[model samples]
Target: MRFSVFTLFPELLRPFTQEALLGRAAARGLLAFDLIDLREYAGNRWRKVDDAPYGGGAGMVIRVDVAAAALESLEAVPDEVILLTPAGQRFDQKMAEELAQQNHLALLCGRYEGFDARVETLVTREVSLGDFVMMGGEAAAACLLEAVARLRPGVIGDEQSWRADSYSSGLLDYPEYTRPAEWRAQAVPEVLQGGNHAAIERWRRDRALERTLARRPDLLATAGLTPQDSAALLSAGLSAEQLAQVGAPPPPRKSRKKTPAPAVPES
Candidate 1:
């Protein structure tokens, strides 16, 4: 996938893409980046991209003209031009999967108080990391980039890892242990050491259910559960109301293992 991240501080996002999994993906051509500096489109000697709001706001607002110009500079039309803002849709694993399907993407980083409201006209979508605000969209852009890039083929180096990831299956991830069997008086579960695949799968699913129940019970409303899984959870103390909310597992989406990346569309 190709990502054009438009930011005033391109250098800040460079090292993030250059190191870790993103770096490796770029090396193999599974991912691409065009960290275009937004300041270049400022159209001024000082390259000013932001100005005080017309209504006299406390902080400056990114100019719509500059942002639109920066987006127009892309060589290829992106499937979507994502504008990062606190008000956009709350991003999730599902959205990440959807984005992975698109071959090209442009991320518009907001600075100061954020973009002029009219800038929305030029963007295909708006995304938010969460409820809180940030100094700029560079950090949010980096986060969204990494999550989507890893879903592409060969990025994580393991297809199964995607399937078992938290929220990929509509449940929290099971516990994991490593190294010495016994550490600090804590011993690895015997089910793991016995090499029983079926038993291990059951153990994992059960643990995942337990964790999700104790934490985000809300996820169970849409999470697909097998008869056996429902039975196990029912036995494990899922109440009647939650059980009513449970649904049969939806058909699994097609896997994106071929080509350079898969969406895991973080679905």
Candidate 2:
């Protein structure tokens, strides 16, 4: 896959492109990336890419002219043109999987307060990391890139790796251990050391369900659990009662009682 990032701060994205998994993807030709400096598209003396909003807001908006020009320079139409902003669809693992299947991706990293509303008209889609805001969209873009990269054909060696990852099937992953069975007085699960593949698989599934139930019950709503899976979870010490709590809403807090007024001092 080919990813193109148009940003005012291209340097902010360099670190990710040069290290760890991303770096490996680049080296192995599993993925390709191009960082286009949005400032470069500004031909004026100061090379400005933002301007005060027409309605006069606290922060400057990305100028439509410069942003449009930057996008035009890409020549070919990307499979998806993603604009990073807080107002768009929430990005997630499913979206990452969809993006990895695309032939090309163009990411526009909004800066200042936000992108001009007109900029949205050109992009094919928009995505937001979550509810909170960030200093810039560069980090969001990097996140999107990493998620997509990991799903590429050769980027990850194990095909079954992602399938078992947290949220891959709406359930969190089970605990994992390696090296010497004993570490810091905590021993690895005995089932893991037993070399019984069937038991290990059953144990992992149950643990994954338990972990999800404990940490993120909201996930269980869409877990699509089967009767066999439920039995497995129960056998692993998690009862139907415990599984019931997975998606249960917390009870409302009790209101505090008001203090009584003191009797009048004057007679």
Best prediction by lDDT: 1
List clash counts for every candidate, in order.
Answer: 7, 0
Q: Where in model 1 is the C-alpha error above 4 Å? A: 247-267
lDDT for each of the candidates? Answer: 0.88, 0.85
Model 2, runs deviating above 4 Å: 232-267
| RMSD in Å for all candidates | 13.0, 15.4
TM-score of 2: 0.86
Instruction: Kindly give the stretch of ten consecutive residues in candidate 2 with the minimal lDDT sum.
Output: 245-254
lDDT string, candidate 2, 128-193, tens digits = 999999999999999999888888887888968987898877789899999898989999999999
